[model samples]
Target: MPRDQILTFFSKYIESELGMIYSESNDFQLQNRLEEIVKLHNFANIGELYQSAQKGITGSLRQLVLDVATNNETSFFRDPKYFRAFENLIEKQIKGDLFSDKELRIWSAASSTGQEALSVAILIKELKQKYASDLSFSILGTDISERALEKAREAKYFQLEVQRGLTTPQMLKYFTKNDKDMWVASSELTKHIQYQKMNLKDAFYPHEGFHFIFCRNVLIYQSVESKIKILSKLESSLVDGGFLILGVGESLIGLKQDYETIMLDNAVVYRKKQKILKVA
Candidate 1:
């Protein structure tokens, strides 16, 4: 088979599996990544790799492709405004007793390397110390990359990773340096956080709905239809009047009408719109 045909086949396959778009503009990127995979796996060429993929590449090869294709660019508290917004919302909820049983549930949908989830945990810890001593919360950190999840579970970061969006006080307070000089997340942050492997394109349901869901920096890679589907699922996974925090530039303007846009601090967030019942 020709090289163009192989690239086209793999591009479509990646979209069908991951819902990640690979247009002509990004063809070079896709081709480069595919070639890297070919070299990594010692395949003769892209065509040979494609042939192997077609012949039941269900295990390692499939996971390798997915891992290579995924963009796991994340940092601790990547968006300060959003974190401040989340903190304010939680504080308000706590004061108003909006929590049903003094317990909060949060989902970091594309958790990446667990920074976002751990950041939420750190905020919750602070809130518990200052306002509600008995407040308890659980954070679910999920991603599509097993490699990323492994690193997240380790909860260790190099100096540069810790320095990105983390202050000196926060780094000293929440992390301890190991012999290898890697900063590890404190127990207080990790105790309530759990990591899992999840694909946003698939249907997902949590055992219980979350008060807030952070599915950031991911929908941009998906098609508009895929984005709508993902947004619908994320909405369903939220409790009534729950919040959905997306990436800084992401908007739901033309996608769905089920959410009410609101601003907390300087960050824009969405709240699940309550349904009005009609009397027959």
Candidate 2:
């Protein structure tokens, strides 16, 4: 078969499984990204890589391909503007009957390696001095990558990963170096997190009715259909008036109308619109 035909057949297969759209406009980008994986796996070229993907690619290698296609740019307190908004939202939420049992629940959907989720915990801890008198919180971080989830469960990161969004004071207070010289979440910070593997395409999540759901930077790889389905599920899974924070570059346009946009100083966030039932 010719090269274009082969590429077409395989791109469709890849996009079907991972929902990463590639076309004439962005084929070069995909090819460039796949080049490194080809070299890493010792494949001669794209042709051999496709053959391996068709039959011989291991589960882990398939995941790597997906990761390469979907850029997972994340870090602790990534974009402080959003963190500031989140803190303010939490403070506002506690002033009313929003939470029961004095417990705050947050879900870091597609949490990757868990930095984002831990950042939320750190913010909560810092703010506890003022309002969290008897309240407690739990953060649930979900991702499709088992390796990422393993690292998240370990609560460890390399120096560069830790430095990306962490300040010197934050580095000192919330993390310590391990025997391998890797920075890790402090003992206190990990207590509130539960890392698990979850695919957003699924109809049900492990937990539901989250007070705050952060599905940041994960939707860029999804198809419009997948986006609509997942966004709808997320909206329904939130407590009435609960928060939904998307990535700064993302918008809920042409997807679903389950959320009302809340413009903030730093970033844009959304609130699940509570349905008011009219008596029949």
Candidate 3:
């Protein structure tokens, strides 16, 4: 097939199937990735691959496209400032007689491979040991990729993945090294976290209310319209005055007015406005 035709097919297919938009300038990358798919599917050429995909000769191939397009390049504690801010938020929320519920529920909305979720779990464990007594906490990690969720559920990581965001003491406290030097998260840290597969663009919300949500860096890939829609849904799922953390580069400044932005030391988090109760 001609390059223009191939580009058109990919543009429409990606946008409709995975909510990804590929521009003309992405020809080289798209061609390279498509070639990999073609080789994997045993297609002779790009044209053949497109034809087979159109005919549904390979159902899983379609899913593969979506996966490749949406796969994120992430690491443990990609942003340290956010974690610091998170620690402060937790401390402030639980210090005085403000809430005093002693129960905190957190959601890592785009927890690619569970590092962020596990990181939060580790921090919470540290906090519980230091200050809060008999605190109840749950951290739910959700991603759109089943494969990623499976990897997260395993609670094992390569040495490289474990190296960042963890000190030697933290590693010794929360992880065990296998024969290959791979790090496996301790059962204690894993106990508080549950992994689930969720598509943020879905019509209905997957999880219930959460005290805090980390959806950083994921929305940048989405269109502005999609971002607003997803943020709106997230707002509904957050408790009033609950916190929403986005990537340092991501913001809701001009996107939505429903959330009030709160600036921490280095992180800017959004909070839904609480409705005041009126006395009769």
Which of the numbered candidates is closest to the native, going by highest lDDT?
A: 1
Candidate order (lDDT): 1, 2, 3
Task: Give one digit per residue, the lDDT tens place, for model 3 in 204-233.
Answer: 874567889999888877778888888998
Model 2: per-residue Cα lDDT over 225-259, one tens digit each: 87887888888778888889988777898775768
The lowest-lDDT stretch of 10 consecutive residues in candidate 3 is: 93-102
Best model per TM-score = 1
Q: In model 1, how large is the Cα lDDT of residue 146?
A: 90
The model with the greater lDDT, 1 or 3, is 1
Report, for every candidate in turn, its global Cα lDDT versus the true structure.
0.88, 0.81, 0.80
lDDT of 1 at 265: 94
User: How would you encode candidate 1's per-residue C-alpha lDDT over 185-270 as one tens digit per residue?
Assistant: 99988999998888988876574889999999999899999999999988889888889999987889899658999987999999
Candidate 2 segments whose C-alpha is farther than 4 A from its true place: 1-3, 39-44, 56-58, 277-280
Ten residues in a row with the worst lDDT in model 1?
93-102
Ranking by TM-score: 1, 3, 2
Off by over 4 Å in 3: 1-3, 56-59, 97-100
User: Which scores higher on TM-score, 1 or 2?
Assistant: 1
